[model samples]
Target: MDDESWALSPNARKPLPELIEDKIRALITNGTFRAGDRLPTEPELAQKMAVARSSLRTALQRLQLQGVVEVMRGRGWYVRSTDVAERDEPLRFDRRVSDSDLLEVRIALETTAASLAALRASQGELDDIAKLAKLHQAASVNDKDELLRTDEDFHAAVVRASHNELLDQLYRSLVPQLRSYRRNSYSSAEVHVRSANDHNQVSWFLRRRDEAGARAAMTTHLLGLYNDLAAQTGMPVEERAGLTNYALEDEPSWQQNR
Candidate 1:
């Protein structure tokens, strides 16, 4: 298909990148693009969509994050999968799993990853995690995109530092859903600052090779998120009680604040 056939409307209610993402998915659904099909070059896509190359790149990145498409180094973007709808099935918020349920799984995966990272992460990985932590901590509340990106990067770096390929892969698989969860969860500047501080605490423990401290820090970080989500979702008292029963030496600061 030619680039002309992919032109998007000039007037769009949604963000340009989001509209472009939907259009691409529609094309894929209609069989215009399939697995292994190379998408047009960025310039071509930009021209056809009447958007800047940056916007086109943003849409493509979001698709890549969702596992619908992937970019090959020095090549072009290609359709990675056509089963986009099914890809997010298991973690679909409120449908397949509650938001709290997702965080519960994250708590399990990330706390252990943090502990392993403290023991196994090399100096270079530890430095990267520290750098990302600082960046996320310094992100401006006014810039939600940067804040979100930095937050995701910090966590991913921590997971990567685990040096466990399977653990990293599992965390990567949850990126899209977690990204969605984060978008809805960042309700205030206070929340952002608290999260950034949590990242710093995680990095601090990892740098010192404090396995127990790293695990506890990660637990505190995610438990704050879990509590917030539970409150907002009106999670059942019994369910909330079950999920919040983690053993710790001291009360989490967030809980103390409340």
Candidate 2:
């Protein structure tokens, strides 16, 4: 226990490292500290969060262990970018800005490709998707990371089984972006649970080779991420195109806003 550990809401039941980890995790998960952004120095963070310097160090070390941040020699610790843990570590952000633009195009392609996949997926592909969805539905707090990775793998698997070499190539090439989106999408347990249910429904329909079912399931599920936001804020779906508004209300981070 440390001086400020007693001040956190989760209580001292969680260790200092875990408390610090929670804070850092909240920042990344809430989009407060995005990729490529530098983390505050140890002392600065310790002061800002009212945590003991030693406790903060422990937290940073734990984050490093999780491959969520790094300590550069002679420099300072920085939040690890990218959705994936270590395997996706080396993916630098120096790539062209077209990557973000291409993401919109990829989303359209992927959404349709998943629909086509519902029509043509093999027994094995269908089985895997169903299995992953089930696991996600049954997942608990302790299994969040596992469920998240399995969910991504299942989606990527669908893209791969679509039988279009060009589509597969394009999708595989976009894994980095996909990973980032996945991370950004699941900042709350409510969202994760909703997505898991939708995935399970999609998987069930795809298994039946119902093209309409699969397409509708996928489109509805994916669009829900933004549609829910728009609806919550009373914004028309079409009007959302040119707006920068997130339109999400009572988000988890808002509770932390000073």
Candidate 3:
């Protein structure tokens, strides 16, 4: 297909750069652009998409950061090879990612992801997130395996909806530790109820595009989990906070809620 075929009508609700990125991602995913295929020049892409050159460049830069494409100094961008883009080697975890550390990082990273997802996620992505959350909530307390998988899917979907490939990559690399933490935290029916409430709040904020609300919901959810683990394991608040660089505000609402 010719570059002109890529022309995109401007969206009043979405940024031009985002629209450009979505189109390019669709092209790559659909096999219209194979690995190692050189993309049209920046000017050509901009003209073809009917977007400003700056917007086109921004979209390309974002894709490059995600390892979706490689930019050759003067040559142009090329689709990244599958072997390189989706390597077989597993990401190595720091030998020391304790439960505390995992929760700490989850609070920091997931809250930000939720915030961005509120701003960037499409309706379809939001639907997927809500569906997973509902599935997790509806699973029988005895059905541990299904509950765990559904919970993971809900969180993973939120990260993907953030539209930041680097964040998605980082979260995925921590899956092993995350799974362990979820297993430890989901022991009580009360905890499950609390989690369902938190996830519902998260989905609500995301649907409304309320960034702060989404961030707060995610933070509250993870902090609640952390507090639960700390209580169950008899770990000190200070020690847990030290693992992920969080401060213990004595009697914080998140901790007090339980």
Candidate 4:
């Protein structure tokens, strides 16, 4: 493969890791790499692609998550599959599933996960959750990628703390789509601050083992995002009216005992 030829475009708006992912995927599509082929070592690929090793690792991880590649311990990354139709499945799913649909799924899964985490998380798990939450809160508002990465980490930590392997797997499956949604949805510093605050609130509840409070906080966080996405997409008022109704009727009860 001609690594230099895969260099990212100067005008691209996607994050460096995502751009690198695209380049690697293009390599696969063009038959430069094939199933079971060992990719160049991380250092070589990083230098050739003009990306940091960390960014390259991130791209490789995302590809692994999408079933396009895999990493062999002490060996190197390898192309796991090169079926164009199979690789495009996620993109097709994304196009069919709207942001609101994703958020609704998140609300269901994460709220329950948060509740379980509050009840089941060990001291060490709780500490990890708190640490990730703090990292997210302290992330620079000017750095969207940092904010997004931290945000994803915090949520994943909470899900892991739930100690439910099945839930963790399901959440991991949505990660690539969630990453894309977060990238496009972070429109301002205010939104970042709001998210950080919500995370803090959720962390606090988890620390106290307050299941209801944790569930409520996660629900509120996701619903707020849902409302924002609905507005941005110009969703019909009738369709959006339920969001307002749910918040008005249920959110306060959750917070009242917090």
User: Highest lDDT: which candidate?
Assistant: 4
Flag the better candidate by TM-score, 1 or 3.
1
After superposition, candidate 1 runs with Cα above 4 Å error? 1-95, 241-258
Runs of candidate 4 with Cα error greater than 4 angstroms are 1-51, 60-95, 241-258
Backbone clashes in candidate 3 total 0
lDDT per residue, candidate 1, 11-96, as tens digits?
55789988888888888989999999999899978877788887887788677656678655457889988987755333334456
Better of 2 and 3 by TM-score: 3
Model 1 TM-score is: 0.65
Winning model by TM-score: 4
Per-candidate RMSD, Å:
6.6, 15.5, 14.6, 7.6
Stretches > 4 Å off in candidate 3: 1-87, 242-258
Report residue 73 deviation for candidate 4 (angstroms). 21
- lDDT by residue (tens digit), candidate 3, 37-148: 9998988787777778878876775565445676544477888743333632336665866777777777778888999999999998888788767878897887665666
Better of 1 and 4 by lDDT: 4
TM-score of each: 0.65, 0.49, 0.61, 0.66
lDDT of 4 by residue, 1-258 (tens): 555686886655799888888888988998999999999999999889988998998888777666678655457889978964555434345256766777777777898899999999999879878887888889988877788877877887788789886786577667777677787778888998899999999999999999878988998898888778878889876676333225445332321111
Candidate 2 per-residue lDDT, tens place, 54-172, comes to 77876675455345675543367777654433322333456564433444555565666777788778887687677767767776635545555556556665675576756755555
Displacement of residue 217 (Cα, Å) in model 2 is 1.1
Candidate 3: 10-residue stretch with minimal lDDT: 249-258
- Residue 169, model 4: Cα distance from true site in angstroms: 1.5
